[model samples]
Structures are given as structure tokens and as C-alpha cells.
Target: MGAFRGLAAWVVVVGVVFLVQGWLSDGALVFGDDDGLVEYESVETSELMMDAEFGHFLDRKLLQVTGSDRSNTTIRKLVVRGDRRDPTNGFKKYRDGYDVKSSHYWASVVYTGVYGFAIGVAWLLLGALITLLACFRCCCCRRKMPYAPRNRAYFWIPRILAFLLSLFAIGVIITMFIRNRQLHTQAFNIRDSIATSANDATGAVRNVTTTLTTVETLVTKYNIQGLNSGIIGSTVASLNNQSDTITNKVNTNIRTLNRLINGIEIALIVMLSITLFLVAMGMLAALMGWRTVYFLIILLGWLITALTWLLFGLFFAVNNVTTDTCQAFTEYLQAPANTTLDELLPCVDLATAASASNVVKQGVNNIVLQANNALTQIEQVSASLGRPTTLPPVCDPIGAAPDFNFTTCPNGTVLIGGVPQVVAPYVCPSNPVTTACLAQGRFVNSTQEATIKDLSIAGNDLVAIIPTVNALTNCSFVYDTFSKIVNERCPPARKALRNLWISLLLLSIALTLLTVSWIFANHRNKKPHLIHDQEYSPTGTTARVK
Candidate 1:
């Protein structure tokens, strides 16, 4: 009986001390914060828009300023500010959802500590009461058995406390499970949005290529003389009207596409909000649950399971969030296809590699060809508007056979003909040989000037390409920077998580010790005869028995 009391005292004191130590030393409470969950948009859409707007201003107004190089500064700053609406909004763009800041972490830790202390005290009190029952049974009760009323009443109190403790452990498990599921679901939705954004980005690039190709072909057809007949003229006019219509359509679609991408960015913010809420709720549930359980072994198992679930949730959450972030940044970064980086980056193959691939290639080719044909009709109209009577040279080819010349005119009023008569001399588009690479079959020296002129015209049509490349470069830089931040912060975040686990582990140990002490105390009280057996020492008559 005395042994049981001694064991109970040790359990009460030791469990209380360990619980207090864990509470005080717990880094989980002090270090855990939701800054990790705050979603960082690797691509700032507003910033990109501002850059694009400023570029537009530079091309249209600032660069044209008479004798004022510094004019760029004023217009550049104005365009940027106009596009941003509120420059401070750029900073606010980062996800600032419900955050578990440093203070929250400390608050959680303090709350848990208080609960742990209460639990420890309750367990110690239970132990002491059990030990008292055991002592009374072995000594005073053996001589004069206590009334059934008193014995029953004493047993009831510990039984109620044990039941309450079990309920608390179960509650913690349930709460943790709920939080885990919520976080997981939120992450999944964000992943879906990422996929959608990626698809939109791909589609936008295809549209750009289609538009550029169509414009190029139409520009070429404008100079083809034979195509300038009356029917062709009307067709060209109709096509010009259609071209204007398509241009508007393209612009509208591009804006719509931008809006779609931005919507996904907002979803990223929502994802962070969900993450923070789940984590905070989890913390609350965990602390509350741990306090409810009285037994050390049961509490320990429950806490371990809860911690495991939390880590598993984080594992998936981190991956989903990281991937979504990457895709989101890439979608905006890769928006422009003609920027330096864009030209350097691998583009989707336009050619077919196999029979199956040919099917898709052929479909896309047909679409591009139709789009170009529409532009050709429009260019013919513009050409006719410039000169109506003398059909553009290619449309008015004179002789049927080779070596035809206008010098053979019978009246001798000869307008002069042949290759030299009709062909316009080629002029190099620019001094740099790099930009004016000769087209196929055209030697560097062969009609170099004429070829260069043609190349310059084609290049001018592709002027939008450069800015697109620059945008991509900026986007990539943003991606790399944010990725580094996430990676660097991950280590400390993981450590904080580990500390949380350790605190739970200690709580479990305390519960197990308390349970063991209670069991022993119960055994001693129920078996007072063992103490009496030792005291009797084989005497003919028991000390309190006949």
C-alpha cells in the first residue's frame, strides 16, 4: 500500500515537472508563424502592365520629343504611375491573408502551456487521491472498513476524471483530421487553377503567331499586280474591313486572357488564406485536445497521430502551392513571345514529327493559311487605294516567254521592259548584316539591296516581338527571386513544425506516466490483504482477525 502511495507521489511530481518544462521550453509556441503560408506572387501583373505601358509611351511620345533626351524620364514616370493606379497596391498584391505572426505563435504557446499545467495538476491530484485511498484501505480501513458510501464516492471522482480525459484526446484527433482535409482541398483547387492558367498562356501565344503570319502574307500580296482586278479590288476592300474587325477581336481577347490570368493570381491569395486558417485552427484544437486527456500513453499516441497528419498535410500543401506559384509566374512571364528571352527559349514545334503529329500540324497550318488569305485581301485594297490604273508589277507581267522586253515596242515609244525594266532594285534594310539575313535562294550579293528592303518591311511588321521578349525576362527573374525566398524560409519553418511534434511527444509521455501511477494505486487499494499478509508473519492469529 505504501509502495503504491510512493509511486503515485513520484508520478504526480515528475509528470507535473516535465509538463511545465515542456511548456516553458517549447519552441513550437514561440517560433511557429504563418508568414510561410503567405502566398507570394512571383509575377506582379500590375508591374508588368506598368512596364508595358511605359514602353508604349516611350515608343509613341517620349522618344519623339525634340532635342530633349531627358524627356523620357517624365513620360516614363507618368506612364508607370498611371498604369499602377496606386503604386502601393503593388506591395499589397502579396497575399496578406489571416497570418499566424510571431505574436500568434507565442500566444498559442502560452495557451498550450497553461492548459498543459492545468492537465498536469489535475493528473497529480488524481494520483494523490488514489494513493490516499490505497493507504486508508491498507491501514485505517483494514482495522475498521470504511462505509460503502464513502468508498463509492471516492472511486466515482477519479472515474469521472478519466472519462473526461479520454473524451478530450478523441476530440483533438477529430479536430486535426478536419483541419488537414480542409487544407488539402484548398491546395487541390489552387492546382486546378494553375493548369487552367497554363493552358490560357499557351493559347495566347498561338493567337499571336496566327495574327503575325496573317499580317505578313497580306503585306506580300499587296504588290502582286495580277490580283488587282475589279473583283479582287472589291474582295480586297471586304478583306480590309474584315481585317479591322479581326484586329479588334484579337485585342479584346488578349485583354480577356489577361483578366483570366489575374483571376488565378487572386485564387493564390485565397489559397494562402485557407492555409493560415487551417494552421491556426489546428493549433487551437491540438492544445485543447491535449489538455483534456489525462492518461500519458493515450495522450502520447493521439498527439503523435495528430502531428503526423499535420506534417502530411504540409507536404502536399507545399508542393501544390509551389507548383501553382511557378505556373502562375510563368504564364505572365511568357506572355510576350518576341522578347529576347522568348526568342531564346524553346517554342512549341510548328512542324510535324510523326503521322499523329501531322494531324495537329495540318489543322494549325490550315487555320494559319486562312487567316493569312484574309489579310491578303485587305492588303490588296490598301494597294489599290494607293494606285488604281497601273496594277502592281507582279499582277501586270507582260510577256509570255522568257527575255521579254518593253524596248521591242513596234511604235518605238517603248516604255522599256525586261527584268531590269520592271524589277525594283533591292536595298539593304539596315547596315547590320545580322537583322537582314537573305531569304532562301537569295545570295548576299544577288539583289542585296532589294532583298534587304523586303526584309526590312517584314521586320518592321514584327516590331511587337521585342517587347514580348523583355517581359519574359522580367518574369523569369521574378520567378527565381520568389523561389529563393520560399526555399530559404522552408528550413526554419520545418524546424518549427518539428518542435510542435516534440511538445506533443512530451505531453504523451506525461499522460502515460499518470496512467501507470493510477493503475498501480488502484491495485494497492483493491488488494489490502497483501499488506496484511506481510504484516501477519505466520502468527497463529491475525492482528485484526480472529
Candidate 2:
């Protein structure tokens, strides 16, 4: 009885301790359920800034396609729509762009942390309950229960339950992680699709522009001017030749750009689908872990569950992945609208050319004189309409070196006695026909030069984006945040659970061995009692009396 009292006192002390532990850990008494769910909303101002920045980024690419940086040159005023003009002022003062939350990795980190905390709190409670139940049965209940012939069952059940629950928790984490990963991958495909489409459009516009400029240049460069009866016969031939060159170049660029766009679109669609499927699978896997009940079937189930949770972090990191998207211009070229072949075609006065040349011999003197004057007047008007040649280079020619003491010329242009003169600037000659030809040639060269410059700049912008984009892809907020939690919250929490599991398993095994030993010890003592009773029967008592 004293032994029983001592055992009961020990059980009470243990029970109180376990109850207190439960309250501190898994119990509802200490912390509220919402303790871990706190998060901050993205600032509206920041979001607007983010949107503007992206718009500028887009505009810069568009400008690049047309041989300009109108977008980037004007970007500072456009995108930075806040009190502080400088980034050095910090994010607090700056308005964010479109998809502000998505743009910042820190947002992802916060989200991951909150998610981990909430889920961890729940799992902590489960562990506490498991520990309490396990401790109670081991210390108190087993002692009072009747010893059945096969009593190992009672000792093993609670341990199995603890192990199974731990495993389930781990699996839930994995599934969520995988789902997040898939979402991130899908976002990448979407971004790529948009970029590819934009690139193709830019290419097409550039190609057509270049072809038109080239055709215009060919007509003007060979001194081909004044199309009339004499030249009219060859004018159509010249136009045809120019047109063929333009057509071939345009067709080649368009075909190439179109093919690239088609391939990218197909690839993006396939990848998006695959990513979605992976997300769904991850979710399904988590659900299965949640519902799993049997530990024996889920060998290493706890580890898998931990991995699942870790995967949730991975998914967050991946989904939050960002990359730079810009227009491709170096791969294409653009020309101005007015530089096309149609614009370069000369306006011919066919009647004047034909009638004057044939009928002037037969006309009256006044009519011939009047027609010549009219022709001269028309020629003056045409020359006036052409680009002016009086501008510097057109009016001046290089003279022989003057006999002077000075020797060197200025950097940009030839100089006499080291004096600076502007280099030969573009100029049109005074001859109406020649001036028209020169104008066309200048227009074509200028347009093509501008187009190539713009395209090349655009290419550089896109390439510059590659490193920044790649950087975004390589770094993950979710992964960083989750890893922090693992080091801080998860690792320790899991270790506690694992230790608890091991202790339970060992306790159960120990109980099982003790029970067997106790039974054997009792059986042997009973056999001795039975033999004594038999030996002390009536016949033996009578023999003792004699």
C-alpha cells in the first residue's frame, strides 16, 4: 500500500508538470491563434511608383526601336513621380511601380515568415498534446490497468500516434512548397511571352522602315534625276530595280522575326501548362500528407513532411522571381516615314519636256521665247524647292594652302593657319534636278544612320537587362526567409518533436520489456507457491505426527 501511495504521488507530480508544459507549448491558454498571422499591406504610393517605373522601362525600349532614347532621356521625370527625385531618398519617399509587391523580394520574405509562423504554431500545439498524452500513459495509467496476457499493444499505440502525426505535419510543408515553385515558373513564362511579342513587333517595324530608306537611297545616290522623255524610258527600270532590293530585305527580316515569335509563343505556352500542373501536384501532395493516418505505411514520413514545408519556402522564392524585359532593336532597324521610295520619286513635267523639244522648231518666235522663259522659271522654282546648298560646304571649296607662317588645321575641318572651320555640312546644289537628287540621297542616309543607331542602342539596353534579370532569378526572398525560419523556428521545433518521438519510442519499448519481465517474475513466484501448497497436504501432515 505504501508502494502504491508513493507511485500515485509521483504520477500526480508528473501530470501537473505535463499539463503546465501543454499550456506553455500546444495549449490555447498562452498565445492566440492569430499570433503568427501579422503582415503589412503594400503602400499605395509605392505601388504607383512601381507602375510608373515599369512604364518608363517599356517606353525606353520602344524609343530604342526608332533610333531614339526619348523614353529613357525623359524617364527621370516620368517614372519618379514622388516628392524625392532621387533613389537615394529611399523607398519611403518614392512611389512604387505597377506590381509593387511583386517587384520587391522583401514582400515575399514577409509573406513566407508569416505563413511559416502560423503553420508552426498549429503543429506546436499538436506536439504538445502528443507529449502530454504520451507522458500521462507512461507514468500513471499503465500501472493501474489490468495486465493482459498480450499487453504490448497498450504501450505501443500512443507512440505510433505521435510518430504518425509528426510525419503528417512534414508532408503538408512539402506540398505547399512545390505549389509555390510552379506558380513562379508560370510567371516566368508569361513574362517571356510578352517580351517575345514586343520584340517581334519592334523587329517588323524596323525592317519595313529600313527597306523603304534603302530604296529611296538607291534612286538618289547615282545622280539619277530629271525624269523626262529622254530619261522616262529608263525611269521605270530604275524604280523596278530599287523596289526589288527593298522587297527582298523586308521579306527576309519579317520572315525571321515571325518565325521566332511563333516558336517562343509555343514554348511559353507549354512551359506555363507544365508549371501549373506541378503546382497542382504539389497541392495534392500536401493534402495527402494532411490526411495521412498510418505511420507504418509512411516510413520516413516525418522527413518528407519537413521537406514539404521547406518546399513551400522554395515555391515562394521561385514565384517571386523577377527578370528584366526589354525590346530588341539591334536585331532590327527602323526608318522615318517620309524617307520611303514614293516620297523620293521626282515630279515630272511631261508636257513641257515633250512638246517643247518637238514643236519648238515649228513655233513662232514669241511662243518659243515664252516657252523657254516659262521653262527657265519652272527650273528656278524646282531648284528653290530642293534643299539649300548655300549652307557652308556647298558654297565653299578647298583652296590651295596659303603662303603663311601658320601650318596646322583645326580638329573637325581643314583650317588655314590653325583656325577652325566647320566640316562640309550637308548641302544641296543649285541645279533643280541635281538638288532634288542630293536631297533624296541625304534623306535616305540620315534615316538609315538613325535607324541603325537606335537599333543598336536598343540591343544594348536589352543586353544590359540580362544581368539584372538573371540576378533576380537567382535570388529568392522565400528561400532566404524560409531558411531563416528553419534556423530559428523550424529546426528547433522539429528537433523538439523528434526528441519527443525518440523518448516515446524508447519509453514504450522499455515498458514492453518491463512488462514481460514482471510477468515472468510473477509466474515463477506462483509456481513455488503451488508446489508448497501441494507438499503441505493431509497425508504429509499425518506422516509428520508419527
lDDT of each: 0.34, 0.30
lDDT tens digits by residue: candidate 1, 95-190: 221112323222322232333344445555665676678688878776632222235445444444444343333333333334334434443443
lDDT of 2 at 310: 38
lDDT of 1: 0.34
| Candidate 1 wrongly placed segments (more than 4 Å) | 1-29, 32-157, 206-526, 529-546
Q: Considering summed lDDT, which 10 consecutive residues are worst modelled in model 2? A: 324-333
